[model samples]
Target: DQQVKQNSPSLSVQEGRISILNCDYTNSMFDYFLWYKKYPAEGPTFLISISSIKDKNEDGRFTVFLNKSAKHLSLHIVPSQPGDSAVYFCAASVIFSSGSARQLTFGSGTQLTVLP
Candidate 1:
């Protein structure tokens, strides 16, 4: 069973518009949620993140909202630009122990296309 799921395989948006991506997770132990953006032939880079204690987090044009009770999360991009076109992935991690590395579980991914 997948702990994290991105139901949408892709999304499209016009430049300077908003793009929304959704995610769902099955694990309650997840304390941290993250979004990553990846381009072809490159590694996924960190985008935004939210802690379980907070309902939302924002960084410039990107924002992430978490609803623990519903086990759902969404990422919003405001004024989406052409450069923002890429594969977006939702990831969740639980802290197993102090001083231990976090193991992240990632959703498949959602490809975002920004049309000019």
Candidate 2:
């Protein structure tokens, strides 16, 4: 049972357009969510994140929104550029009482292609 799901395997966006990537989770215990972007050869880098207590978080051109009731979340990028093309992964975590301890579950990545 995959806890986190990204139904769309891929998405294509033109430059200067907005790109939206969707994700869903089945586990209600998940308290925090994060998005990671990976280039062709490099490791996945942290993009943006949102906690269950908050609905949205923004970092420059990237924004992450969480809908706890629907168990859904999304990553939005404005003015999408070709350089932004990469595989994005959605990760959910259940924070434990052990301070930094957490159980993380990752969704299959969705490939994003940005056209110039």
Candidate 3:
């Protein structure tokens, strides 16, 4: 019973192309969605986020789309660069600790290799 899953463990795309990562969630209570990017040794950093009320959110070269009815979400990076090579995690949570630490539920992760 996976509450969240990233079926594709990896994705490779040429530089200046587009990279798309997908995620699925089974919990209907999830209200917040987020994507984090990670390098080899560094901790995962927030890349983008979307609220349950919206269907799409974008920042610079990154975009995230949500399909609530399908319990699916995707992160899209346009003009993907060699620097974009890293792992991506899709996390979902509804119960954020009020005045406390944020607890995140992360997907397995999808390694994106942006080749030059």
Give the top-scoring candidate (TM-score): 1
List per-candidate RMSD values in Å: 1.5, 1.7, 1.9
Model 1: colliding residue pairs: none
| Collision count of model 2 | 0
Question: Model 3 TM-score?
Answer: 0.93
Off by over 4 Å in 2: 96-100
Give me the runs in candidate 3 sitting further than 4 Å from their true place: 96-102
Per-residue lDDT of model 1, residues 1-116, tens digit only:
99999999999999999999999999999999999999999999999999999999999999999998999999999999999999999999987567488989999999999999
Tens digits of per-residue lDDT for model 3, 1-99:
778999999999999999999999998888889999999989999999999999999999999999999999999999999999999999997776583
| Candidate ordering by TM-score (highest first) | 1, 2, 3
Stretches of candidate 1 exceeding 4 Å from the true structure: 96-99
For residue 98, give model 3's deviation from the true position in Å: 10
C-alpha lDDT of residue 20 in model 3 = 93
Residue-level error in angstroms, candidate 2, position 102: 0.8
Per-model TM-score versus the true fold: 0.95, 0.94, 0.93
Model 2 lDDT tens row, 5-32? 9999999999999999999999999999
The Cα RMSD of model 2 versus the native structure comes to: 1.7
Location of the lowest summed lDDT over 10 successive residues in candidate 1 = 94-103
